[model samples]
Target: MACCDDTCAPFDGASPAYRRALLAVIAINATMFATEVAAGLGASSRALLADALDFAGDAATYTITLWAIGRPLRTRATAALLKGLSLALMALWVLATTAWQVVVQGMPRAEVMGVIGLLALAANLASVLILVRWKDGDANVRSVWLCSRNDAIGNVAVIAAAGGVWVTARAWPDLVVAAAMAGLFLTSSVKIISQAAAELRAAAAAA
Candidate 1:
């Protein structure tokens, strides 16, 4: 088997370095979630709100990943499936909320979006770097990397939406970005679920 493959041996939570990295990431995500939720509400930015929701989901999943690190393949795969389902739920929530935002139309505060997006970007970038080395592995490990990657991408899009809103003075950019992030979340969820299912089968066969 290839290195870090779940079928043979897994080195996830076994490593002190990996555990430390995850702890730092969990702290970063929790802090960002609180900050962004407040800023998103104050600014009335759908993109920011979507990003904040993502941060909250990430915080929860990262904690799950830490818990499942050294677990059996089946256990880890089940955990990954839970993470994937949670992401799908969050995506649907964002889309529904964004549609409602369209009904009650209003432009967000561009300045606040820009400032908060920048701060979020920095936080996610730090998380990405910290988890870069442990990016590859089983479904449980891969899900953590995917979430971190999505957060960074979402932050960048939020920044772009801020600029677009500033130029056009419309909520379209914010709404569009939120919708796009929802799409990203769904796509990642699919990947995580697929891999986790396959691992589950493999684990059953081995058993």
Candidate 2:
């Protein structure tokens, strides 16, 4: 019974500290989402908009994670499954937007893209540092870590795309980066879903 209790405890019974970290991350991600979306629209950068959407998705996922804390393993797993679905939807939306931009938009403002991308990187890095300790926790906690990790990676790609656009004066780089970020979202969602499903199965078996 004690072993089962240990296995099921959210954040390994450090829910209080974990919840504080998540709250901070949620605030950072939410703020960055708003700022990046405005910059994305103003600069007409599909990649920037895609990353902004990712930030929004992460913020929501973190909120879900916060809700799951201190709950039973089954409850947390269910919350993670919902987060995974949301991530998949976000990827699909980004892919569609990228396609539309490919057909309609020209080269985005390279300067704006580079600057905003850098700012987003800083924000995500801060969140990553805050959540680094709990990166190996349960599915719900790991999902939050995965989101921040992917966001940091995507931020780097966005910066690279900005540089590519600056050098080539072309729209292809931005569209390519947007597609890549969509791929990241899809991949991470699969991982999160699998982990959550596994937890659910284990919980059922124990029951």
Candidate 3:
């Protein structure tokens, strides 16, 4: 399904202010991606690693959106389609890695997980606030908003996983959370691809 309802107006991709906002969000995501990846490795938390990948993917998506802005509608829709495929691929990678970690790794550090997850949550919340006004935009813009929204939600889940691991002294919570995050990625990507596909079809019909 599309991100916006039928009542919403078409997205304004040419807005200079919107482009500037996206640039800020891209920087935030890229910075968070580096921090989360390092922390995820140090803490040995699959959930953190998954979230790091998400941050990286979002950064790339926004970059693509920036490039496609002020271009043809078909071009923007194409970029969204590519971004959706990339997200899906990343989700599969996370799922595979999570499964491997479950089979081979021990419990991760709950304290580290909690601390880094909190940091990530803060970063994503800021991004969400910046992009909240564009949540109902066209497929390309809406995909960016969805990425921020999902990252925020995933960060909360990571914190919950940390708490669960701390209480139980087990890795199951971390693994489960990673798996759930992968599921979120998959579902959101499918939604984005569907919307982008519809937009492409409409653009074609109009031409």
Candidate 4:
């Protein structure tokens, strides 16, 4: 089977070093996922939930990358499109959840929002650093990079919201950040999906 063969060397299907790096991202992302979820619930913070879901999305993105690393070009392109779609769904979900909390019920715990946000930002930053070196490796690698980069930007917004919360003692700032994060996800989703679709079409033509 292909899995049994060494042809698909893991981590962007490149050298052992790249495989190691990707593996690290996978492990770290998994841990962060659990951490953020628990913290979000404990804090009852929409911002924390946003971070948690963001990490979840990153985990899914990397999982897709690992699965497509050594596949054919057309397969890789299709995988990227699917990954993008998944991201879009996640964004929609987050937006819906945050909107309900903000407009109907109310904002979540502000203190927890800021604290958990900072913690999640640190974790995501580490993930970004880990994947930065492999950003240009392949479509699979680029997808992972885009996911990480988008997440880092979201984290920054979260951090800023935390500061705003500390000062204003309001939920608007947190809601705003959560909405912005969702927007980023939606934007990235479109770009990745379009690129993947074009690549897949080209591959089919070439075949």
Candidate 5:
């Protein structure tokens, strides 16, 4: 393995603006992670729990990005690869837990799901806006944008699941949404890992 990567069109992740945006995003994700964890436990909402896992993952991702900034290309790619793997692990955990939730068959509180989902959606939307300008970049940079976008999407799904749970009066809706979110996490993980692997390979070749 080489210490450098992406000599071509190497991104600008060291900018003051991007750093500030990343710090703000980190704060938001961390806050949301705590909020959703408490609410999910109180409300028995798997969807909210799944989304909370995402928030935790995003907080870690952004922290890694902050650390990788100004580092070598290989370092950034390695960080992204680690993030991707962690995301995959998180997803698998959610999927397995959601299956067990189905067996337990607890009905989630739809009102809590809807309200918390709305709050999460707003926070993720703000993150997306802050990172939009730098969305198209290297694997490490792109991963941050992808996580924010995924959060917004997950929030919408959580809201819909809340409606479904309310209408059907069943636990299936919450379980289904948690499973779907796991799928989303898997998909994003693949993309990030692929890009990061490519960067690593390119760096090795250049070395």
Candidate 6:
């Protein structure tokens, strides 16, 4: 909105370093997506599934980020909108799955929670390290970085929840973490959608 000044520089998108970082993080997240999905099913853990969907949404976010780099403001806004929609969809999926697990599945398979959660945490931490340098980037790039950062945070929470479940032999902690992750997504979706809407309106006015 401010004519793409220094604040929007990293969003210039064509920078090789930025593209490299995005690709690396995407690869990491995509792999984790599959891993968590499988682990979720094996453990019957709703939190794991929610985290898996988060990873999936991040993969799309990174893809859009890479595409929006150096592109027009309108293009960036469109990408943001798409990512926002993805986040909402993933949140819904998590909510439905978690509710079902709570009502029907009983306690999840404890063994898989700790093992898969630790693996996911390690991978997410690596992703954070890769994207930390660009955290202060433009709105588009910052959005992508935020997704990565949130994922890392969620990963830690999932790991801790797994540990807590193991100690307490209860399913509530896992469900709580999953619900928190849903709440995080809900908030992020609103922010991203609002930004994208503003940008689109501005672009339309200019056109």
Residue-wise lDDT of candidate 6 within 59-143, one digit each (tens)? 7766776776557888888877877777777778878888887888478766688788788878777876786676663664665
Best by TM-score: 6
Who is ahead in lDDT, 2 or 6? 2
Query: lDDT of candidate 5?
Result: 0.77
Model 3, span 1-207: residue lDDT tens: 112221222444658888888889889989988898788878888889878867876686667667864689899788878878877887788798889888896779999999999999899878778877866637646665665565677888899999999999999999998888777767877887898899999999999
lDDT (0-100) at residue 151 of candidate 5? 62
In terms of lDDT, which candidate is stronger, 1 or 5?
5
Clashing pairs in 4: none
Clashing pairs in 5: none
Clashes of each: 0, 0, 0, 0, 0, 3
lDDT tens digits by residue: candidate 5, 27-129: 9989998998799889989888888877877677677767876788888888888877887787777788788888888889999999999999998878777
C-alpha lDDT score of every prediction, in listed order: 0.76, 0.76, 0.78, 0.66, 0.77, 0.73
CA error at residue 125 for candidate 4, angstroms? 3.7
Predicted candidate 3, C-alpha RMSD: 4.5
- lDDT accuracy of residue 203 in candidate 3: 100
Question: Which pairs clash inside model 3?
Answer: none
RMSD of 4: 6.4
Q: Candidate 2 residues 20-128, lDDT tens each?
A: 8878988998998889878887888888877876677667666765676567989978887776777778778778878988888676999999999999989977877
Q: Ten consecutive residues with minimal summed lDDT in candidate 5?
A: 1-10
lDDT of 5 at 110: 99
Please report the TM-score between candidate 2 and the true structure.
Answer: 0.77
Error of 1 at 114 (Å): 0.8
lDDT of 1 by residue, 99-139 (tens): 99899997799999999999998987787778767757476
